[model samples]
Target: MPRPLWTGAISFGLVTIPVKVVSATEDHSIHFRQVHLEDMGRVRTKKVCELDGQALSQDEIGKGYELSKEQTVPITDEELDQMPLPTAKAIEIVSFVDAESIDPIRISDSYYLATDGQVAAKPYTLLRKALERSDKVAIAKFAWHNRERLGLLRVREGAIVLHSMRWPDEIRSPESLAPRKVELDEGEIERAVQLTDTMALDTITGFRDAYRDALEKLLTAKSEGKELPEPAEGGEREQGQVLDLMAALNASVAAAKESRGEAGGGEATVHEMRPSKKATAQKTASRKKSTAQKTTAKKTAEVKKTTAGRKRTARKQSAS
Candidate 1:
């Protein structure tokens, strides 16, 4: 387990839960380094001045905020650090609110909390079980990552988990993402909802990261000198039909009911696709096969080129 990055007491009224925050998630995606094409050497970037085209030293660099399209307001780190609030300390809970009241978008990252040296187990249990029973999450204010954050605190399992939520203005509105809707008949709606329900799994595990896995497979094939087949072309999308407000809403409610039915289904899939060792092995094998096929194709191309060159040489010699 990783050590907590920050430690503090979470207080609401007279209750204080002495807790340490540890990151709840980690990303393990492979990263790539840029290389120079000509020499096939690793590429390095140099910092240079935009105005003068001269390389800048680390000591000479300073932070600046653009006041306008052309004007910038430069500030020193020393001056910014002298603010009344310590960016490193204190997660102050300004007010109490029902956890359900907060928007889901506000919840950004979550961290696991561990008890401080001597916090009472009874109070911790009291808070956790009470929140669980009441179905209320605690909303608090804190400083993190150089800004004041509004966070949701909930007792998950035995300990309290803190989720740093983004401010409302920071997230784009749903209006910005309103382009993917389509009008549907009652039958199509039912079928699509049923398919969605069938596709849904209890938890989000056992599934491969389809896009990421495909990308890795492609890269592996390239590394092995394989030729990839072109993807089948997609048919042009037809224009979407407009939805009738009341009818669409009724259909959506029905779809939601269908989703609930899937979630509450009694029967478990006999295959138990996720959490099975066999499924994972099959996926890995598929990736290996695709990469190997690519390598074989490249070798065939090379051999064809070699054979052609030998034939040309024989023809030239005969003519001479």
Candidate 2:
């Protein structure tokens, strides 16, 4: 059994269902060590007091808050405990709302919530089934590792899954993040929407992370003492956006139909691409074939020339 990252109770009015929070996501990216460039040796970092040029031991360090440019306030663990806050001991289910109504950007990490024992089984199962049937998600609050967080609780594969959600304040307004904006015309918008419909995947498994997979493979090969030759860099690819609403809707519908092997009445719109993927592949193969044929022909001609010259030399020698 996997160890729980946290243990708490789900509270609703007078109800409390004891549960354990186990991580649903796992990251397996390979990590590397930093080394000194001069001697190719492992590098170590040290923490030292900037003002006094003194290195403090781990036990000597204390937490401090910088109140102003020149002012500082220090506090101990006991003082931190006395800080005014609600008890960080429960997953309080506030209310349920449509899952689709929540913005995708607000989602943080995911974890599975398992019932602790007999007492918890009832409410846990009830909440899970209710959310699943209603197609709604519970917006709950929970305390994990001393910090209180807002979370979205939903049913996933017969278990209650909790997703830590970013607070509205924590998430930056999209407009502020990227200020640039471009308006699209009707035709362009329609075409882009059509393209999206054609590329839509339903089960998530339909899409694969090609770049990440390739990078992991590269790292693995290098780690195994087999360095990969640098890959040829392909220039930037084109991207699209929409401006016409109706046209885009029409295109999306058409694309959805075409994706289901229904590109019947019209020729499959060969995606307009610079050196389209198909054309690039064919060109590369043709170039290889042409190069091989040229090399073979050159060798054959060289042999013929050599043979003729030898025959003439023999005749000249015989006549002399």
User: What RMSD does model 2 have?
Assistant: 11.7
What residue runs in model 1 are displaced by over 4 Å at the alpha carbon? 15-18, 51-54, 57-60, 65-82, 86-88, 95-99, 119-126, 175-197, 218-320
TM-score of 1: 0.58
Please provide, for model 1 over 95-170, each residue's C-alpha lDDT reduced to its tens digit, 9 standing for 90 to 100: 5567768878778888987777665556667777877887888777877655688888787667788889888889
Q: Locate the minimum summed-lDDT window of 10 residues in model 1.
A: 266-275
TM-score of each: 0.58, 0.67
Per-model CA lDDT versus the true structure: 0.72, 0.79
lDDT of 2 by residue, 197-273 (tens): 66667778666666777888788898798978577575445445434455445545665676687763233332332
In candidate 2, how many clashes are counted?
0
Q: Model 2, 179: alpha-carbon shift in Å? A: 8.1
- Where does the lowest 10-residue lDDT sum fall in candidate 2? 265-274
Overall local distance difference test of candidate 1: 0.72
After best superposition, candidate 2 residue 176: deviation in angstroms?
5.6
Q: In candidate 2, which residue pairs get closer than 3 Å at backbone N, Cα or C atoms, i.e. clash?
A: none
